[model samples]
Target chain A: MDAAVTAAFDLRSWSAAHLDRVESALSRWVVAEAPAGLGDAMRYAVLDGGKRLRPLLVLAGAEAVGGNVQAALRAACAVELIHAYSLVHDDMPCMDNDVLRRGKPTVHVQFGQARALLAGDALQALAFELLAPDDEGIPAGVQARLVRLLARAAGHEGMAGGQAIDLASVGLALTEDQLRHMHRLKTGALLQGSVLMGAACGSADAQAQDALRRYGAAVGLAFQVVDDILDVIADSATLGKTAGKDAQQDKPTYVSLLGLDRSRAYAGELLAQALDALAASGLRDTRALDALARMVVDRDN
Target chain B: MDAAVTAAFDLRSWSAAHLDRVESALSRWVVAEAPAGLGDAMRYAVLDGGKRLRPLLVLAGAEAVGGNVQAALRAACAVELIHAYSLVHDDMPCMDNDVLRRGKPTVHVQFGQARALLAGDALQALAFELLAPDDEGIPAGVQARLVRLLARAAGHEGMAGGQAIDLASVGLALTEDQLRHMHRLKTGALLQGSVLMGAACGSADAQAQDALRRYGAAVGLAFQVVDDILDVIADSATLGKTAGKDAQQDKPTYVSLLGLDRSRAYAGELLAQALDALAASGLRDTRALDALARMVVDRDN
Candidate 1:
């Protein structure tokens, strides 16, 4: 579609409708009455939190592939759960030691460290459980596919693997290639996996799937690149998290390696790459994915 | 199905063969080359540790139900991964503050708290990944079923939920019913889940499934009762963990509530109940499950 058509697509309205579905589904699905108030902590970590970017990607990707509605919704919620759980654990004193997240006290700060630990663990399990449902509303093949995609994204070879590199790389200077590798595993895998999962909900042929993969990769890396830029430029108030903390922690980043100007330029390049991939996808509609790509690169947060 | 026939079934030989399969599958499947040494910590936590009782239970349960071989093996490892991950997290300073486990330093003590946390998180994801493989060796329906079963066992409603209660109930004088509820969630869910998951790998009739469920419940509870008894009576060296830990932490247990003689008798009763359930299952062969139940109640450590 042309820029005029894309601009007229009303991304906000689309997001609003989808986010409503996602929020309601999450509220219903996440356990709130678990034994010993564990559910309370789980609900606290997940509900009313973050920007829901992952869910948007899932929904958008599913839309691109004409994916199954039920599967898409579950995939959306499951990806978000994984994201939320990572934040909970990362904020622990043992990990990032951060006190604040999304403008609220971190889970460990609010509900003691032990409950926070279990809450994160439970959330991770819930992600997989949600992906692989008992009923046939989502096909068995689709269910297993979603589960594999999600687990690979969230598991050791993906997000956790990246986080390990992050933890071990403190005070070390990493080359651009090394930084990209880490970011690709850490943040990029889940973002790409979200799209793949959404596509898995439906049937996307090889060509279309490959194009979406490219789109997802470009968009995912752009997110981290933009994040690095924002850390340098945005304040904690605007970011809804502690900004410039990467520098404080001596962690390597795109901005640190390439300078602010180069990092900004790199994010722009990635956005263009994402848009090109979406154009080449051969799908009739990719407005949501297009808008999300722009939003990732342009958002103040 | 007579006791004489059961006695002649050779549980040790059966377990030895299955345990070998489980070990090899685990070694090959659990990520050993994850970025930044994360894999090292994960392997350490999972390998050369514990009795692998959960895997044994899963294999036995599957055998009893004539489960699909591939799915059964995956379920066995998946349940054990959940068990191992739980142990890793539970041993952290914020939770049990355990220094040693499986006769060695805990994950946190050996790998540091941060890597321990990530390793546990990754392992949980891997469990679901293993359950929901991409190929068709295990049917998609079975994959989805196993994921649901394992997640419910490991998530907020099961192990994590039980742990939350345990954390809250520390130093409190819990009644027998209250203790049972806590232990059921903490340990029983996964144990029962292993059986249920094993059953899920095959086409067990509803009647047979119900019988297996009963057997699982009885055996699961008996395992914990025996654990409590061992905590009081067995030495740390014998138990491969710190004996008397529950008492030292002021955590309530069967020994603390019902005392030794009563706990022993209760365990015996549960074992009988388990045996009865196996007979009621009407499966052609339940010798493996029968032997496992006996092992759970009769083992010293």
Candidate 2:
């Protein structure tokens, strides 16, 4: 097989293994059951099927810096847990009130909003716990940076801030800048953190970190734009979840502001920019990243 | 001064210094801006007045093990941040819906529910970031243990689970065992974690850790019992917040089940148990821990 083809297969296999490792670690860590009921709610929320994109970014970023992908797995898992928590809370009746996620009923829908809220809260706390360095993982400073990055991304200026803006912007005709601002905080923060943290875990230098960050930002925005496009174009059956909920709610979206074609075009442009940033970094191991970026835009769900 | 008295005074002084350090570190760290709006909300929630009990536990525990109080401050601050976040969310309109906390408006009332929720979420993430071993303070294993302990305490089986049970138990009379179970998850998890993490940070052995945990659980229950008693006896102004809200909400309390006098007596017994645990630990630095146990029952706010 060609090197590119081999690399593609390797990436898929590696990503799957990384995800499995994360799942196993979570199982080992969360044992003990008077709490059995609480565990059920959390498992329902986290085990719902999805692409697991954030963790892929962490592993790929780590690999790009010549670090062991396995070593970065806990941080990757931590990021995913944080993401899952956000989804559970966002689906609460008082928040976005989402009823379905990844083809299954949302946490709030399945477990009730109060439990869902607590599950999210606990998951968020658990994410930090996961990131606390173990004896065999990446170095302490790198671990600290990863924790800091994930925290900031998950925090107010990042996901939560984005959520606040989203809540506030409902029924309001947000400007393009306002819409972008919300996306950056909500989706972009963790997306960027995922890649940067992965790279930092691998001990990437300042220049490399900057390049990875730019790459992350571009792809993060691109990911959302693609999501907007899919929301408009894909059917619920194909998407494996309810589509057009955003429009039904009259929440502002990239497609709403830019139209379908423009949004798709914007996603492409961002992908190109992300790829260009990756290229400029002059790193040899970013092939996985490049493929991941392309896959992001091309994904239908 | 006698050794015990001197130690008690030292702990008081050290706690103040530790709090100051946490405040300064947090101020210094949140310099970046895209998330600026949420950042402000986060700072507002964290900076508000509270007892600072969890952080003090971390500092005292570390000091007990002969660790530098300053080194443990970041971890201490992180736990406090998580606690603050929980309080913020617990008071939301969709949750407990309380209006007053520490004699001031709750975060949701002051900043709006959406902002408060985001702030709480962000703060939780920030807490982990604070603990992730950076810049010559604590070791990675200690940091890891801290993160794991705090996470487990905050998650489904701990504080969040406790909240779930509390919500479920409303309007329904619960047995004392059930009530104790609820308190253990809701309040004791974090309390036990606070002392354990502090001792671990100071490099306490497993035996010491277990003893501290026992001390923590006793004091933790005592703390809640005292709060319940005060709710009946203390005025809103003296309490620095509303005192009758719990009864008004008809939430389960030791006082409701056991009456005020029994609750007070139970609290005293718990305090004695905590002091006894401290003595059993055989540490040279039991003075601070002893004072803390006494303070838990006597505290008015």
| Candidate of highest lDDT | 1
- Which sections of candidate 1 miss by over 4 Å? A1-7, B1-7
Q: Output the TM-score of candidate 2.
A: 0.88
Chain B alone vs. reference chain B, TM-score for every model: 0.97, 0.92
What digit string (tens of lDDT, one per residue) describes model 1 on residues B45-86? Answer: 999877888998888888777789999999999999999999
**Tens digits of per-residue lDDT for model 2, A167-242:** 7788889888998889988899899989987887776777788899899999998898898888889998788778
In Å, residue B115's CA in model 1 sits off its true spot by 0.2
Can you give the lDDT of residue A292 in candidate 2? 86
Q: lDDT of each structure?
A: 0.91, 0.79
Model number with the top DockQ: 1
lDDT of each residue in A1-301, candidate 1, tens digit only: 5455455678899999999999999999996898787888889999997889999999999998889999999999999999999999999998999998998989999999999999999999899889877675788889999999999999898999999999999999999999999999999999999989888988998988999999989999999999999988999998889999999999999988999999989999999999999888888679999999999999999
Per-residue lDDT over B138-225 for candidate 2, one digit per residue giving the tens place of the 0 to 100 score: 6666666667687778877688888878887878797899989889888888887788878877777767777898999998888888
DockQ, structure candidate 1: 0.90
Q: For model 2, what TM-score is found for chain B?
A: 0.92
